[model samples]
Target: MTHFIRVLEFSNKEDALKNFCGSFRSGESDFGIFSVDASTFGSLPSSVFAYWMNPSVGDAFSRFRNFAERGLKAQVGCSTKDDFRFLRLWWELREPSDKWIDLAKGGRYSPFYSDIHLQINWKDNAAELEAAILKKYPYLGDSANWVLHRESDYLKPGITWTRRTKSDFSPRFLPAGCVFSEKGLSAFIDGGSRKDISAALAILSSKPCRSLIEVQLAAADKSQAGGVANSYEVGIIKSTPAPDTDAEVTERLAELACRAWKQKLTLDGIQESSHAFHLPAALRDRLGSFDPPAIEAELARIQAEIDAIAFDLYGFSEEDRAPAQASHAAARTDDEETDADDEGEDEENAALIDQTAGLLSWAVGVAFGHFDWRLATGERAAPPEPAPFDPLPAKSPGMLPDGAAPFHANAGILVDDQGHPHDLARLIEEVLARVEAPVPEDVRRWLQKDFFPFHLQRYSKSRRKAPIYWPLSTTSGSYTLWVYYPSLTSQTLYTAINDFVEPKLKEVGADVTALRNKAAARTRDDEKQFEALQAFELELIELRDTLLKLAPTYKPNHDDGVQISAAPLWPLFRHKPWQKVLKDTWAKLEKGDYDWAHLAMNYWPERVREKCKTDKSLAIAHGLEHLYVEPEAAPKKTRGRKKGE
Candidate 1:
């Protein structure tokens, strides 16, 4: 078997072992080579690798629950304004939604209530999901019994390492928290303190260590596609040497790793307040000042320093470092190949759009009173309450009158004190300003052209598309109404038309009439005026007809949501657009472009599949037909007793 030994590539082999000392001695070193082929190497006994590798809990569909952002109440994780959507909660039917509420567990005081943790069914019974998981994969045992107890495993003192069972990517070590390990990946639990974990990660990430691992894996038989020949079995990992238990070195390596990880959290815009350690004063003082490149450079610097430490631990001579250098160089070349990903535009643009979607969704919630006003607008001093049942005379001085709170419960941006809904554009502008992001140029044009398509792509997942906002429109693009999900009903369609479409049609009709009257009054041959008048008349006719076409969906006592099937809401903003809209949305969804499972269309798959024939296979591949739909049991048959009778 071919072995990719680091020493083979080194030009200078002398003086390599003079400065070397085995700290942990987890592996056997024969001569200058660390080979698993040696009899004693794989058998080197050690406790550092005694980890409880969690089992694969099947596909993400069965174990992962992602809440497409419904409202502020559905938001979860340590996400900050920048990466707010990094973690979103799965809606729980039992969670309170009638009044002011925060998604934070323990009502905002719990340290980790807002941070993302390993969770199943963010809005459902987690225990039930766990039970089902064990029932199907009983080999994982009743409790996934491993080398150590799992009583406080989530919060246990240890480092966590993740390796894809089938991917070619290098392993990654993350700060241990609540995370799920499914069939594709192996997670090593129970290392030591956060610092110890960092040290372990540093060693494993070193060039020599990675080279040794790659050789071993390549020598093993390839069992899966898109993966190396060998799995990162516990034996292979255990046989890799660990840095000697040097407290000072461990602490320094840990500091660098911890700092780098913290910077990453910051770069992603996760809320710093959610983490246990406060950012150094220097970093905190310059909040929002660091850019992506700067953060990346700092992280890279830390990694290089750790690599240097690993060299000393493994006693690699100057000549033996070529293999490690070559590996890094190859990684760099791969990155360069894909450097033109977005035509050299800022990748943050995508992040910004994603964040914009989140903000708009949050605003919709605030408008409908699904979320507390203070959560978005920031908390303010409370208004004084009225004295309860005081028997004071009306003439009493210095007494305040009984009054309501500053903000009404369930109040939204759509309507005002007079119960009149504002123009959709006006409400959106207010929401944009509240979130502090600039409204894209030509906000209406943006929505008409780009936003809906982007939104469809964002939520296009099987059994998961829960769009909280629905757009109702006529096929001709002659009229449109945007309605909040929580407030939608058949009556809402009628009310929106009455409030927006009907009034606009009347105003246009009056304009056309006046134009015709002026043209009639003018005796001179006014060719331009006649032409303009003709155009206005045509527009008025189309608008009136569009309104008529939409009226049926709002029939009284009808279940508009069920009957309409979002029919009046199509051709999305115009007729025949559904062909491209459904095609593009379904294609991207099938390709796994979107992250969450909340596409509004997924709820009614059969209707869409029947309506759009071209993308049927794509839809089916994503399991749309059976997703969120129950399977019918086979019909029971009874035998006929003809001869006996």
Candidate 2:
């Protein structure tokens, strides 16, 4: 017998099985089918039992056998007597090879010997077989239901058993009915037919029709709640179908479009697409169709009305406007130019006034001094000359002097009308005294003098020297210490001035030298302090920067006079020993101990202090106390247990 079979691949095995089983009963008579088994189904060489049942089914079966021989030798050879026993049904009527060929053609008659070839149609029976399995195994009911339905429609309506000619055997029919007696009975139906076939298949493959007696029995059982039981409950809440009204759908679509537009706009900013898509077509068209000339005319009319109102209120005329506005603008420009010129002149005048004031103040503070000399009687006066480089003569004839004044000379003793000594030594002493303790007025007058003592001496000598005796006085005078001798009075006067002025000049020089040394030491101290303060300030800035970098969210509160708390990872300034040092350093800095603070803090604070002190706003904002660190006590050591214990 020959059977027509259609094979299909489904989205999944369950879908294939559902198609097969759902068409089980109705498919039987239409297709003229008797019984169906896995052995009569289309070949699926991927399954092991199918390959064994239909070894020569098709090209795929031949390939599958070759693959199995090489790959699955252990599984194929391990089969027992029962594995090949499925062929025993027709074993008495046909050889093993003939039965194999028949099964490969979907349970049709073998074509090897064309002895009375009968047409057998088993497509409907195949679906019925799937449904019967699903009835036996409820777990597979849904899947089998679909496969039964699919198979009934895929094959012709009635079962037609036909003969296959010799050499017509193929593997396509092997998968559907192979392994029917063993695993196929429990096997899931593979519902793999297309949609049109699926629903028709379900109606065709329902359970077999029952006799009147069987129907009566089923009715009695149902009345007793035993047969054809309704096990499912109807759901109370019914789902409403989607609205089909055009307006409702249109509103929904508009809402969705708006939401999508907003989402896109938020993500990508306001751009052409967002704006264009957001507007309705009608609005865009209306805007595009607007009349530019008409709008412009309306605008002009409004502007004219405004102009008329302005003219009525302010007495302005269109024709008189231009020249008057220009004149007013020119006047304003001229006024501004004049003001700028005045400002420039004022600046220059102020500068000149400041210069004049400074000059007058300087002039008022200068000092003046005067001197006059007249030589003693019998003393010679000499013209002004450079002083000799020799030491002053000794008091004793042969005693060497300890030190000498290089500029000392035997000049005449002179006096003014007030009896002030006009000797060179006294004059030198007075001049040196003025140099050392120079009043501003005295220094000024001294600076004004032309030849100084030389001019005075010339005047003194001309006034006091007798011409005849002057020559004798110049050559014959013996140097004497006593001023009582008129011949030695000039030598005595010069010597006494040297004696008095030299020591005081030395004293003044020493005082200046000491003052310079003290100043130098103070400067060094100041520099050290400044350097230390600078380093401290730098460290503080670095610490602040580090803190800022670590916690960007931190913001100092100026109103609250306390340092902000630091992040957990950042060590507070107060936690370190350096804190105490900083505090001490800060205190010293406040007290003008710049050097002390610099050394203690190990950084410059002068820069920091100057920055803080000069800016009152900054000083108050960053409280001065924030710069200081509070002292903390050292940790105590724990005592150990006694050695004896």
Candidate 3:
């Protein structure tokens, strides 16, 4: 009884003669009929995974794809070989590190990082862009580029791609797959029964097939030491054996896989909703309620059920099932733990964050004249439509620094010379003051503490790097402040100084003087109140002086054209390069001694000088001028009390 199995490498032509002789010899022998070839089916090459190997320009090819806003599209929507992972399958578009130009669009070039590069809307610019890209990357003009270049027509309903090669040969399913892929990512697209293909996709995406792929395919490149470098060539992939296509079992597998894919899409949908600053009240309530966790738990259960079905289909034994079951269990644990961490006040906080974010959005709109005073009365028909590069209106009711009372004016006030509202600061203050508790107990405090954190969480999924309200601050975070999108304009700063800062200074000065008089009349019993007022007075004085000094330097220079911060234009649009800004701004803004100029100009030069001046002034005021220059002695060590003492 000669028992020999042939594991033929389907794509390797050199193995054909060897396979033929082995098969003939086996048939000639007594046990010839017992010989079986495990990999006689389709291989990976039978699938469609094309790479656009273009000329690598020195850094110039790196331009259009970047971590910043200068990318060809909103960002480089490509997937690299390293991006795909089991179950958590998705592509992360990246910015080009090397510089590239978009000649047609007056942009730079970028080497292919993903297979899916063309946009559905890029049809108008396709020929021009294609010509320019091919000129710079002539090699990309190969016939193979046809599929990708003509992707709009080919991008169908059920296309998918697999990682060409991976450390683990476990299949990664991309239901919402891209049009093209990098060299190591292979895609699958052909006409067939939708149900059959979906079932096959699920079976491939599941774990049982992973064990089969490893046993039949050739080892990939020996590049990484001590790591399994497995390859999934088209020939070998197609050669993977399976039950009959029309079998009842195959239908069941297809149904399970489709269900799992749908569940994954649900999670993606949830994440997409949270990406924007606002969440619908219904979604917010559901997320805060019992729905989200329940859905997550149910999804995990479904995946486990699929794993069991796959085991039976693959004829995996108890021992083989051990690893697969363990993998499924581990994944379930991770999902549950994630759910547990997100429970409790998470939903409430998310809802509150959304509400606060809406308020901030409204304020920005008002500041930019996109919104009118009707927002205050809750009579605004719809949120203001945002435009990135357009000039702001001279004065919407909420945006005016001063204005006349129009007919039916709810908050009666006279109009300015420009026929706008007077006292922009007053409107802002009133709007903020009227905000009820918990939505934001204190708007300023909320902005200073929580807004950035929430924004980070919201945009984390998209990996957006820019922020609408850029923060400028010192390295130490001891001084941080905000710059609204419009405020980045050279003109807005000038307007703000006269309309916003000057009036604020007057208000602070008035409060300081009132506090000073009260302190003068205070008795020993009122020391705490007197000290509190004095501290506040000092802060106000510093703010007043800072604004006064910045007045001359903050002149309008519309040509500087709002700096880099205004490029994103609106908060709703995607932004990047915001993380660093947010980090520095939050750090500085949290400190009591931080500068406000950092907000006006994205620089902080006066931080050290101001701190020195503050220390010197404080020392002189406290009659400790000498001590101020000297390092203080270490505090005396305090002894712990004995049990009785």
Global lDDT of each candidate: 0.38, 0.24, 0.35
* Residue 162 of model 2, lDDT score: 17
* Local accuracy of candidate 1 as per-residue lDDT tens digits, 287-326: 3364657777887787688778876766666766665566
Instruction: List TM-score per model, in order.
Output: 0.49, 0.11, 0.43
Worst 10 residues of 2 by lDDT: 232-241
Error of 2 at 35 (Å): 99
lDDT of 3 at 111: 10
* Preferred candidate (lDDT higher): 2 or 3: 3
Best of the candidates, TM-score:
1
Model 3 C-alpha lDDT per residue in residues 1-645, reported as the tens digit of each score: 233433232456457556656776666543212333223212222321111111111111122221112110111122211111100111111111111111011001011101111112123323322433433355653332442345332223232333332233333332231233322233343444556555665665556554444334432212221232234544445545443334777677666665554443333322312211122222233223425466567666765666677666555666556654443333322221212111112222222345446555444334334334343444433225322111212222233233433222322111111223543223334544543212344454444455555544443321122223443322323223344443344354345445543554476567657656775686775666556545644653454355455444444222112222232222212223454444444454335223212232234334433443435432332233453354355688999989997
| Preferred candidate (lDDT higher): 1 or 3 | 1
Q: How well does candidate 3 match the true structure in TM-score terms?
A: 0.43
**What CA RMSD would candidate 2 show?**
54.0
By summed lDDT, the worst window of 10 consecutive residues in model 3 runs over 103-112
List the candidate numbers ranked by TM-score, top first. Answer: 1, 3, 2
